[model samples]
Target: MSLLSFRVEQGDISRGCGFRSCCWTISRAVISSGILFRKKNQVKKGCSSVNDDLFVITDAPIHPEEVSAKVESRDAGAVTIFCGTVREWTKGRRTLYLEYQAYESMAVKKLAEIGGQVQDKWPAAKVAITHRVGRLEISDLAVVIAVSSPHRKAAYEANEYVIEQIKKVVPIWKKEHWEDGEQWIGDQLQQVEYPDGKPMKGSGTDD
Candidate 1:
């Protein structure tokens, strides 16, 4: 198993690093995948304001209601949510579980970028995205996406768009474990692979 290492920025104390002694607490979960291990507070990035708009990457459990509340608004007639979960089966294989990892900094950046794109395409829409990275058991929520818009049509469309863009752009990778074995399966689009045994740093497809 491999773990992606991060160089904590000298001043990003919000990321748990700085002149202070506080730092991100690492998860004790064993590194069981060739992809990466899930660590507590390993990587976290998101909005720094009071608005509903947000983007986050973390190793914590994601709650749909919490995420949906972030994007809730009286003006928004419709609020759409998309929850991605770990399934027990894929193809013909009975999956045991899944391990997810990401290039945290870049993944959050891309997620924010996708949010920008959503707002650009649907100017009246507000979006919030929370993607969990780490070990996920069958039926566990891996991601919670919420999009609110003035109209239901716009909300649905924007919500779908966010996920599609995430698959194409976000640097999050999933390793599937089945009864047989496990492997570092690449992006959702199947357009990228970690042939060298790990994601390529600073690359869009590195996830």
Candidate 2:
């Protein structure tokens, strides 16, 4: 169980910080003993779980309706779903399509761990996560996460947790294609911070 460290921006974890905080407290010993534990926790906190009911694909486009169906379970009282769409701007750059890549096996394994963690933390009915790879146009669905629970709050929190954890832990890479050119953003492995307590900027890759 070697922990990976990552630098996270302040607001980056807004949606799922609560879940991250809870998990971090329980895993503090594991985190504290590892080099770059804070940073790794940041990354882990950002990513969605691989194991649960989640799915990651580098294939063609993803169907939201299908994903929604997969997230449905008889025991669930509520299900929260989140989708990431490819946008046209990044850091003020005019972006074109995006090309996503991932170490598939590792990414899925990590996601499953996240699902298990969510279930342990809350009364989860079901959880599903899916990510798209390959080239994607603007407005294309990049990621989708759904969580079912006995109540709305649990579903909401679990849903938020899944996306944040995905951003942190999954070995997925994205190349931002701009009209001028393209650059590949690598995996995040550091946790740099500002002096005034403000949040940090974009994440870095493990390249």
For each candidate, what is the lDDT?
0.64, 0.56
What TM-score does prediction 2 earn?
Answer: 0.65
Per-model TM values vs. the true structure: 0.71, 0.65
Off by over 4 Å in 2: 1-53, 188-207
Best by lDDT: 1
- Candidate with maximal TM-score: 1
Model 1 per-residue lDDT tens digits across residues 1-207: 334452221111111000011112111121123132234223233322212247887677776656665665657766666777776766677888888888777787788888899989999888988888788888787777778877877877787788778877887887777899777756665534565665556566543
Q: How many backbone clashes does candidate 2 have?
A: 31
